[model samples]
Target chain A: MKLLNKILFGSLSAIFLLSGYDGFSQAPDKGSLSVAINYFNDNNKIPYVLVRVKTKVNGKFKTVPGIPLKLFLNKDSAGLLIGKVVTNESGEATSFIPPSLKKEWSATIKHSFHASFMGNTKYDSTSADLTVGKAKILIDTVGRSVVATVLELKDTSWTPVKGVDVMLAVKRLGADLNINETATFATDSTGKASGDFKRDTIPGDLKGNITLVAKVVDNDQFGNLSIEKTVHWGSKFVSKANDFNERTLFATRAKAPVWLLFIALGIIIAVWTVLILLVQNILRIKKLGQEA
Target chain B: MKNSKSIASDEQIIQDLLPRKFKTSGRIWVSLLIAICLVGIYAYYRQLRYGLAVTNMRDYVSWGIYISNFVFFVAISLVGSLITAVFRLAGVKWGAPLTRIAEMIAVAAIIFASIIIIVDMGSPERFYNLFIYGRIQSPIIWDVIVITTYFFISILLLYYPLLPDIKILLRFKEKSGPGLHKFYSFLGSFWTGSHKQYLLSKKAIYALCVAIIPVAFTIHTVTSWLFATTYRPGWDSTNFGAYFIAGAFLVGAGSVVVAMYIFRTWYHLEKYITPDHFDKMGRVLVLLCLLYLYFNVNEFLTPFFKMKESEAGYLNDMFSGSFAPVFWFAIFTGILLPIIILLFKQGRKPLPMFIVGIMVVVGAWFKRYLIVTPTLLHPFMPMHDVPEMYHHYFPSWEEWAITSGSLAGAMLIITLLCRIFPIVPIQETINEHHETAK
Candidate 1:
């Protein structure tokens, strides 16, 4: 019985010491995750930012694949949370900036883009922000042609953005603000694009006012921008010197017909004649006592 | 019929029916009316300083209570022609005593109608533009012409009948204060009441009676054309002219009845304006109400059956949607209830008929309101890009003040006219009694 108790105590102490070893061995693995954003081009140019997300991990800081990251747009007033992206086999994820973001982000001069990882139990979460400059657009009308010039505004100066796609359209100016015609043009090195539409084809208001719109959309350097100009460049009213139809009665502007003039004048004359006669007759009543 | 011998002497008739100064209540009424007018002036001042934006009117609901009140004035003004011209041409003897009252209502209402339209204009300073750049083809121009012609005719109708009465009042210089005596003399001191003068005046009045009937119809018909020219659901109809004329006659007769009661009670001329007069006017109101009810059915029911895509929304709004309460109230109180009440003998009594008349007039005012605002709200294109409040409309305080002021202004004119003239014509009533006795 003494020999058996000695063996049991020794085995129990060993079992307890082994349990402590097991707890120490199971302490969570501490891994690091870091993200870098770069312009997605062959040259990988700096500062003119494109949307390329890359991640590196482990002590050697080698590229790690198959990690998911979420991209966010942060502004002074609000933040936009967007979809997740998985790293490619090269540990990089690349996407073109969406057109809707380009249009909406125009209000902010500098749009700060952020990428974050929520980190599983094995890794700590990480986040990074990148700021980009906004593009400005200007529009003008030269005769029947519409000109749109796109420039990147920095500090206090303007520089032309090349190869930007621009749109030109003519719209009617009434309540609906309907688009009549549209055409696409690409900017040159000087950031200028021009398009023309027939003035006769574009409809306008009764006084002949027409609206021309110019837009630059979905450009990487300069997002979406638009401007409009109203000009008197459409159909003019027909001469009504010899016309007297129902159109004359319904015309929004006044060009009274000869017949309407005659009728109105005739009515006025007859009524005034009766009124004058009545007045004279009333005055004649004053001579009543004289006649008596 | 009573003999001419039983009729009061001419001097007694003059004593009873001649113009008199106002009592204390009359002074209070005028003072209240003036106070209302002053408040309206202040509201109009705000409107002038701020432009039309001071009112609830926006781009969509541009015309509001002011236009409705103008239409009401024009509608009530038609009574002058009904009593003075239509009844006289038909040789209706019972209409004789009511003629002056109807004409006074017409003159007062027409003057305010013109004034209220100017108030509705965003720029009253440009009133001369109507003449300088006025398009003769426009219904507005036609309205101006007819209303002016009607104004002149109404003034003459009131004036021609008062010549002999003015002479009668002139005989009692002590009864009329010096100011009134001077005014009456200035108006009719030329009158000798000779046979030759009477013949010429009668001939002139006959000629005017013949001419005024067509002019009256034209006035109301042209007013209807102002609405009918638009393509809106409630307004675009071939039946609008007759419908408007019927309503005009109904509301006009209702106003005349109201005036009859007020004049009879205030002046104590119950013997001159007998219960027979109330009974006859009640019958007139009943017939006119039924006629208008028929037109309303034609205007609403047939369109409901068709239910065109454009008209469905407006009709539904009026029948069962947001405007339904006002719509039903106007119909039931304005047309249906008056008909039911006036059909009974007891309802034809002065007091009951007076209540019915008030119902008709009040309902007609709201009815005009419904006619204008709802059609504008249910425009062909949906209302968009406007403030949310514009999607619905209630008259702003300024609008109510201005509208109330114009109404009081009309009443003030009527009150002052009544104070200055014999509301129940003295010489005409005497001559009527003499003829009846014969």
Candidate 2:
């Protein structure tokens, strides 16, 4: 009996110690961020950045928000200053970056946060050594699109096809040399097509020599169609363009929620449990009476 | 007149009626049952080795013949409650000789019912998960809870009535060996046939009878809900609970009839298990079959008329589609034919009733099969992008071995139970004889 008691005690303590180890192991790391972002694609790309700056509030002293931040493409000073904007309520600012920088490059965000007493606040310059990859462009010709507004295809729906290669070829009427201007483009979610033509890199005189033709070669395996369209040189000509906007915006509507079914199932289970208990108690009482 | 004149004294009767060692045929039967059981064990080992892939089950057809067999076992076990409790409560004297037999069937069937369910589990190794991670929300959990309760109650009901008989067996030391004699003594040595002990045992039996009725209902009802709670078309019906219960009673009563015939023939129990018993059991089977047929109509005909988009595939599968033959066979053999045959007075005799009983039992097995398989084949989403084999299901050799093994195991338990104790309670039979003679 004494040996049995000791064995029981030892096993019970082992179980408790094992459970405690599991509990401690499950604690989340405090330093890392668990972040997920959803964004609407104008053309096919959405760019956001994670910016962290140190401060003199209590811990590691460095920079803060709302300071002038500049992004340079390469070692050359010829790179454009993208934008200057203040951080919002979440101490983060998000904006659309031009598609011209589709290749690898590094960036830096410089900012400062003030101390409570307005003393010498630390200036923190945080640099993110980054590489920007090309974003996938999707086009859906079956679902609703901007062309529906113009064409009034009310009966038809347009669906966007994703991951197809599209090429836009252009030519000019006045040039003695046939300027074969070509830019690869893809479609967005609503099948609206867009691509970067790199107009800023070309001289102003040769810019007018551009006529655009978009051709989608292949559709993805899910039956999404690929489309190609041509843009003429004389259509909405805007000269002296500094940055090329290759983004297409599509409209989106909210879907019905999926949680109501689960709620109904939960209620049914609760009612069933209660009914079982009630029946058991009633049966128990009757049994006791019969024995008496 | 001559047989009546040769009536033996109580001691002579007890000596003649004590549980004896197995004869040559009995030894052969036991050996065969044990052999089948061993084969089934090996089959189960293979199943454990290969996972559920050893069976023909796929994602689309998650459940298979094992589940149907489970339902059949649970259904047949209800005979114990019907014969022992319901008949006893109603003061039906003819049911006295059959009570122990029905209770034995119940014990054996319920034991296998539990075993077959574990065989059906995908991770039988993690069966303790049902206790540890058991969610009250799942119908499977409810089934486990009620089945265990029903099992214990049925065991006590069988045990209480057998106490007097155990004391009688203890008196015959040569027939019941030293080991079994000691066992009987240990179990009922204190049962001295005292008035207080009799009162307590009687009260306990009565209480279990009352308690078992609801638990019996809950066991089958929860089993029905395992299907009804799911969104499958043929299975998702309000009438499923009643349908399952009615079918269960029919099968259970049918099993009792069959067992009564077997025990009567083999043990020369013609005087005990009378023709009147078979006639009465026949009448009970007819009523249960009719009730089951009514539930089947409500369960099937309503949906068939509506032919709702969700139910259309499942209904068609059973009606005139792939499963038409099995469906029609179950209806005809399980309910219609048995009801027609048992309706006549001559048909209610021992021989004809025995035939009808076999028909009901076999048909009920297929009926459970139809209930489980066809609905699973018609899940909401179309089966796609999986292996071609996933679209169809047929039980593998391992499954067949295990299923047959469970059946043999049940029979073996019943055989052993009869060997240890009188299949029909000798004391109760003698008491009833005294009452009738007086």
Candidate 3:
């Protein structure tokens, strides 16, 4: 009886331990973090961001490589100059900061590879503090060549301003600027204008800033200005166009392997059919023996 | 010169084999069975009026006593194959007198097995859905097909052998009432008792005996698969089919032993159902019990060995927890105790064997309950978000009424069968007697 008790106790403990181990192993891990993001864009504003990490690595503050380095802004903030772009090889990024006097301002650099390593820096820089002349404007267009399409400027009310003439211009770095050449267009019935301004026909050199001026004929409504906005263009802007083309090509190349998958499924079915026949034959013989 | 003594002619055998009208006690038994059946029918009416809600079964115990009772009936029905087909195929001459009794029990139990399963269904009204929407992969469909085949084969097996007896009953129209006499004649009027008819009947019986073996196996195997196919810890095992079949044969043979004892005692059938018959049946029951015990150990031990995460809770429940007492009782009474008791020669006497048979039948009923309900209670998800009543099950009055009705109904069939036909095969008994005399 004592020996039997010892054996029973030994078996019981072993079973408990094994069962506990299995339960622990199958429990789902819950430590990993997951995130979701939403982006907004409009006619005046595009959802673009550049994220760079300035971190202390190997005892030196260095910028991280291969960060997606993009920026995003809410759709309501489209009228404000928002979003940013990364620097090309020189470790500098360009951004169009909207001239808002509000101090609820922050900048985030989002990285694709190190998606978890998101960083944000808040600044109290207001439009009054940062003088208009000292703030440099950078324009990064995603198209290979600039097309001077209609730039229909509307207020928050969305009403078109008649007889509001607008001057549009472009400049590129390391090129001659033709300041004498400009496209003058007016808003249509639906607040839209379209015309082409050639890169060579631009004033000064192609390397500098392109300034657009909307000179209002009458200041009937709000005390806003016939504002002049200058945009600096560079070579870094051209890669975004190439990125779009590459994605399209990659999607078209993925259909051939899908057909091979169906052929493999047919082969599997054939093998299963043969196995079923063999098992049925064996069962039939056993059944006959039982009857006999 | 060699045939100096006169032998009992075939007419004497036929006259002895003819079914007789019921006596006072037989009439009383039939009336009692009918009364119980009426009460059961009223109970079923209440259940139909109120839905299954009239039962104590809740969502957690969705299947209560009805399913276990169904399993019990199916298990008991398996004896038909054991006595009629298995014994005949093995040329066991001693089993000849018991064959019709066993076959009658099989037919009665299988008939109620079908009825009780329908009673357990939530929508007996939509029973046609079982055929229309039947999934071939489901064990229920397999059970339906095999059980139907087994029932018909069992009926044919019962009928073909009775042709000679039925002709004898038809000739003695004075012993039977006008109504019953007409019924008997209608059933067997085609049987001329010619040599060709006898030969044909014998061939058909042989064919049915052959056909019923697999159908019998398939019925119980598919019934086992109903539980085995599920992924529950207690149920998910390849051994279930054999384990179930073993237990089924045990309980079925045990019931037969009890029936043999009762019929022999009540009808003064000692001349036909002898003590030797009881002794042989006791041995058969003991063998079946031991086989079932071995399978039970295999079914339980390996799981107790590993006790994987999924099986641990279910094993704990059965082993030393809430379900422990019932589990051990079933093990001891259904297999171990019967085996131990039937091992002794004196214990194999009719009275003690009858007691053991009752124990086995009751224990096997609880064993089937353990098979179905406990595993359902221990599904992968924790039992939550249901009413408190759903967590446990006890048969409501309506459920008891219906279940009791089914049992009484089974007894009623056997009682009616015995009233119409000789409970013991007179011709087979006389054949044995003549052989002994020679």
Candidate 4:
């Protein structure tokens, strides 16, 4: 019983000491906050990059949790605010950059990102710069195998990037398989990364369109990139043109049902026949009236 | 009154009701018609040179006033079947004097109906393609079949009834000049008033009367299907067939009333088409108006009650939105006011009925416009990715010109038919008088 009381009292004292330490740490005016950005690649492209804010206290780096950070992209002439995110319990924040931003991608392949911490009275405002390099992905099929080439898009030229890691991924709809068909390879001197995929190992959607993704996620220069291609792998037709018939009732080119067509024709024929008979009857009127 | 009493003699009946030459007013009216037709032809020339882009129609409101005018013509044409076929089958003797007038309206309206539909086509040159590539499944193909059928039947109905009258007119060899006599002989030289000829004509008419009822029902029902087959909110209803047919009968009867009054006043047909005829016809119009009102309620009320998600915007626009004025005007003037005024015996007088008939016709015209345009505006998908003008539709000047020209053409046909033939059947009136005197 005494050991149990000692353990409980020790936990309460530890909580009090932690609260006291937080109070003393927040009163300092000489601390500096810096943001570190990291990206994760699932299929060659980074869906989002993570931003971590750390404070310099007593010449050491400690993560500053629950801080609001503003992310901005610096174009040549101006900086545009992308989004704002609050740091989580892990002192990390994330923002998604859309593929449309790649239109502004220059020959340098380098993007300057700034993360700023503001709107807090206790901490001095701080900002940090993050430089990221991105590479474009190209995929081509050779027989039963696939080759993924990672290239840097410069002004008026395509520069092949070498020694970069590339991954090949295949996506299927309604698939529950945990099987990994992702093949990893390094680009050769020609900046072409080659990988082989078995036809049986690949899956596809109901229409037999297999989406193949080529990815380059972890590169010191190019941060993250991916390109997806939908190919007719197993379907008999190359496009959806053969999926529906133009002679059907509910298709884009709607046609009358067979029964309806027959009925309409029957009505038309019967009416015309009766009308012709009526005309013949009218012509006979003069002769008939003379006899009556 | 004295002339009708003196029509005891067949020769006197001939003199009383033979075709008369036009007066100054008639000449002026014919000139006006020619002028309007010429203007319309010039406007159509411009349209052909350019494209449908000359009209305010866009991807959204593809059909405009041209379709509405076509519907109006078709609707008004149904009167021939109603007055001649329906009344004759029912053995109503009072309609005998009115048959020729109704038939004239029917023939003219139908001719213009065909012309207006051709005008509505973006490429009238491709009209030949309709027959070449026509799928029996298309409502348009069905329309082509039925309208052609209706046109032929209506022509025969107008012709067969006029055979005896033409023979009577041929008796006046010197009264009608060589030109008119030649035309009359060409039309009815074979129409001998023999007992066999009379019997055969009667049988033929009886057969037509019976046959036309169903065909009449089919033409309007099929016309309604052209709209009901679509998924538009205002047009998507089973009641559309009955609604269109009921409205068609109303407008057709109204036009017949207007024609009856004009002929009665101008040709001194008062002796034949008396106030009693006007009273009965006024009553018929009132009943038709009421029946049409019932169908209108069924078409709109249930939908208004539920206000289905798709129909809500269209219904609201009709009830209180941008289209409310036209909607209310069509309902009140086209239907309700006619019903209210036609209910009274004094209002059944010739002049009042004539005014009511004019109101009904004009209002029904705008009603057809509402039926076509508002529903198109409220398509199932949201209106997007179109120019601002596409979101709303108003007929361009070319459309107005063409529409007015078609109307003038129809009037010209009616006027010319009147000039060529007696407005009232002389032999039938004499036959009726002989039977009554017996």
Candidate 5:
């Protein structure tokens, strides 16, 4: 019995300790952080650089959320800070170029950007730089055809950039629709690409105006740059207004389907009516039993 | 002389079944169940404090053992409708002795069904929102409505029949402890045993019996709709409602058999809950098991035959993958083995029937687990982006404790209820004897 008790106590202690081993384990070793930044100028209206932070874990790149990223105009230093943002759930942060950096941004013909992340105890600090020579695509329309001319800013001059690919598409909320069957239009020596708009009539706003966008995406020389031109070349589209009063399954509680309300109310009435009658019967039985 | 003998037998039968005091073994059994319930309560407190994060459920397997446990409770509770409403309506005369037992199990199961569902809801505080913002078109709302209706009807059915028994207990008031005497009076003091009162009580019970059948079917069907309405590959089926109903009746009947055997053995009411009762219940269990097997074929065989690309993975997982053991075990033990055993005359004996009853119940539980988990794991879209742990599921200790607690809690209710009332109806057994003697 003594031997049995000792063995049993030993086993129980080992089990309890092993089950809570995680609570006693050492702190986790940190992984090296990978930071990358890209610049997007959509008609220069919404100019922002998105910096993404990721770390390889178990052979897959997982997003490192809550990392603070700082953007610089041309140097990885504090004085030229465009903006600062903490990474969100997707491990990416958007920092819009502030007015304070506009002077420095315009001073350099070759536009460059830098992003840096200060490390914590879990991760090593890292920085990444990207330089996309300032470029823009100009959209023009000639009878039944749309055209885009790509230009790069050199020293004091905007020269036509050759052999660069330009994609002309109809801009929408989601992905852009191709203008034609052509996959991509590579700019010729003249730095011009054009597509015909006679294939299909796309629906636009109530006024039938569509924004045609010409973009140079992931260009080796000029990064993501897009310019758009609005034209009254689309069929008028009227959005179907939401009717909260509509009665359907998917509708709100107040707008439950009429058949459903009727059936549900009917069943509830029927079942509860039986239940109520039973209650009355019980009461009558009590009254009769009292008389007895 | 015959009159004197009838009176003596009636006295003897009544004396045989008055709620007796617990022996040491009984106290120990009740204590063990109470311990389990306490552990479950503690686990629930932990769950409320830590949130669902304490559970092993994740993106891929969101509905785990909790949902399955809920289904098991709801399914097992269906036996009351089967033994009480169905048998009474069919005029199965022998069902009279077992009516209260079935009703007791049903009432406890349904009450815990409501509770276990709330336990599954992480935001049980918002339960009233189910009513205030409830949509009639949603099957969940329908389930709530029907379960509530079934609950009241079941309570009435249990109560109406027990009125006579309560009057008998009132006669022997001194035999009952002080608290129980007051409870008996509070519950049924108004039942004065008048001819008119008897007629009225019978009519009320009859009405409830008639009312409960469709509500029982609706409750189970609506529960199945909670799954069937989803377009997930395993859940998308028109046959789910009937299938769930069939399975409910089988598991419920199985539980009743187990309860019947236990009650007969413990209470020593061998004259009332006889071997003949076991044989009859075994036949009922056999029919239910066969019916469930038919529905199983309908639920799975067609899906397997078509081998639709969407269903292929789920079917393969059930047939040969990680879930294969549980799947085949449920089929063999819950359905096939019960039928095979109960089909034989010798196998319908109490001991064998009890073992088969346990097998059916245990298998049915794992079957619910299979119904819930494998489908969730085999979604139409591939499982990705989630941590590797999410791809597989095994309930954490907290989940097992709470689920086991809900089960033990149900049994505890049945136990306390048994302590309060005679396991076999004293008055009804005497009435049956009087009618036969006449």
Candidate 6:
């Protein structure tokens, strides 16, 4: 009994001390965040990087949005600032390589990107870094066959990147469709891979323009790289003319189907005319009753 | 005077037919109805405060009890047109006394029908947008037009006949309170019942009788179109318009029978609304039930026979699936048993007719529920990958209260109309008495 009293007294004292800062309440301790950064170079030709901030919530990892991230080039503390961004719904923030860093960009055969999320009351601070060698992919249509070439920068000179895997695909709305049966091909000693222009009957824009892409997935050196080219191999899509003044079922009130409007209007006019006549008769009844 | 050999019989008819203040039971009935209406009003308050989220409606079952209640009210209101316009135009003399009753029911039911439709809308404030930006091609707008026309016509129909009755009511200022006296006078002070006035009033009545028939069919048919235009399994049928009309006529006739029995007993109007009225209305109810049954067979049997892939799930659900019990209950009680019972002359008696009438009404309400929700549940695209709660639906307490309130409010309108005006046409009774003496 004496030992139990001591233990209870000690627990109560701990609670009182813990909550005594603000009259039985204390500020909550923030959870630490995990940060991951990925590099992307699209048809934009300008390289960009995205950062994702996440934290453990209810014993499950949940992406934390609205965290401000600073993406910098090369050095961690005194690097050139590429851009500032805030995380979106998926806890992702993307910032493009700024034009102000063009001189610094051309000076390097390889580059380093650093992303930092400053500490907030709801989350502790976190940072992530990625280093990638400069690389580019080339895609061209050559006599019914498609060819892609991979090249990397080595000491200020373009060198063939051999044995790198390339994916040939047709860009679509949600995801790209593979161009050939064996879509992925490895570059030979010459840094070039070729596939037959096989996919057809793909629907495209009014001018029959479909986008073709040759891409390399995440590589230890190049990160992610892709190039897109527009081709006229897809089926043509002729858009219907949308005239605002057209009269149809779904058109505006004045543009309603003529026959329907006539039928409806005829009925309304006929019915309301008869109704008005009846109401007039009621007024005549009142007049006659007054005279009586 | 005026073709009557005796004045005492006329006075007695007037005394029996004049609106009487409610007795204790009547007051209690009205109070109970008022309580229900108040509860419904409070439910509506909650619905408005918290939004439609308070109801059990979700994406799967967007149209819930409110819509079904609206359909039921619209169906029941069709009775007024049948009893007042169709029968009156057919020159059915026995129908004259019941015209006022049916018209009252019609007016009451339609008022609530419009109100319930507004209650179904998420943004009742934007109701004007429907008018301003309404597409004529839309069946919903067609419904609004027809129903509004029907409302005005019903009001006129109820008013045109009540002029002479109002004049009679004006004679008894002592019986009707000062408030009611001024109200009736305001309604019919100029109604001296001259021949020229009668001629014009008759012309207007005849025109309305003709006008209301087509308008009535169009009203319910357009309502049916609201569902038929949709591509749902049960609703995507060509037979919906006629099927709806048949059911509407059945429920309307059933309600009239119920109202007739109550009025006959409560007012002690045995001499006026006799057993013959019940017997004839019973026969009418049986015919309507049979017609509706025929449509029901046509609606269900073909789909059941072919068992098209799209319709198979809904048909099975109606036949012996999760909804089988409610399905069979609506069928047997609403259509089949009413036919079997009303087939017998004993079932045409006032009390038996009233019981069957209640059955038909209650069963019809559930049948409307089945029509709306079950087809929605068994959508062409099944409700998978959704919360289990979305897979099923039952009315929340708020839905029940608001629906009950709308119904009770409708009845309260009828009750107040009965309290203020004569249920049976006093002039018709006077004319009948004079003819009998002659």
Point to the candidate with the largest lDDT. 6
lDDT of 2 by residue, A130-180 (tens): 332222333222221212100111224333444444554343356321122
Worst 10 residues of 3 chain A by lDDT: A127-136
**Residues A1-292, candidate 6, lDDT per residue (tens digit)?**
9999999999999988887667656678889999988888875388988788889988999998999988899966545998889999999888889999999999988899998878888888888899999988888898767788889989977788888988988899999988878869888887897788677788888888899889888888887889888999888987668876788887878788889989998999999899888888777877877787
lDDT of 5: 0.87
RMSD of 2: 22.7
Q: Which digits, one per residue and each the tens of the lDDT, describe model 3 over residues B341-412?
A: 999998899899999999899899889989887777778776668877676667888888888889999988
Backbone clashes, candidate 6: 0
Clashing pairs in 5: none
| Model number 1 iRMSD | 2.7
Q: DockQ of all candidates, in order?
A: 0.29, 0.02, 0.02, 0.22, 0.59, 0.52
On residues B150-180, what C-alpha lDDT tens digit does candidate 5 reach at each position?
8888889988888999989988778898889
Model 5 TM-score, 2 decimals: 0.79
True contacts kept of 6: 0.75
- Candidate 5 runs further than 4 Å off: A1-143, A147-169, A173-196, A213-227, A240-245, B1-8
Candidate 6, residue B333: the lDDT equals 93
Docking class of 4: incorrect
Model 6, residue B155: displacement in angstroms? 1.7
TM-score, one value per model:
0.69, 0.63, 0.61, 0.72, 0.79, 0.79
Give interface RMSD, every candidate, in order: 2.7, 13.3, 17.0, 4.3, 1.0, 1.2
Better of 2 and 5 by lDDT: 5
Model 2 residue runs over 4 Å out of place are A1-292, B1-9, B12-16
Question: By summed lDDT, which 10 consecutive residues of candidate 5 chain B come out lowest?
Answer: B1-10
Full-model lDDT for every candidate: 0.81, 0.68, 0.66, 0.82, 0.87, 0.89
lDDT of 1 by residue, B344-370 (tens): 999999999999999999989988898
- Can you write out model 5's per-residue Cα lDDT over A1-292, one digit (the tens) per residue? 9999999999999999899879778888877999988888788575678898999999999998999878888887789988888999999999888887778777877767888878888898888998877777789999868899988778878888788888888888998887888867888777798888853578988999888989888876677889999988888997878776689888888889888899889989988998998899988988887787
Which candidate model has the greater DockQ, 1 or 6? 6
> Sorted by lDDT, highest first, which candidate order results?
6, 5, 4, 1, 2, 3
Question: Can you write out model 2's per-residue Cα lDDT over B1-438, one digit (the tens) per residue?
Answer: 112223356665565556768889989999999999999999999888878888998888888999999999999888888888899888887788788888999999999999999998967879998878765556787788778777877777787788789878877788777999888876666556666566666777777777777778878988999888888768778888888999999999998898889878877777667788888888999999999999988888888889999889889989999899999999999899999999999999999999999999999999998999888888877766888877667789988899999999999999899889888787876675565555
- How well does chain A score by TM in each candidate? 0.39, 0.24, 0.21, 0.51, 0.71, 0.73
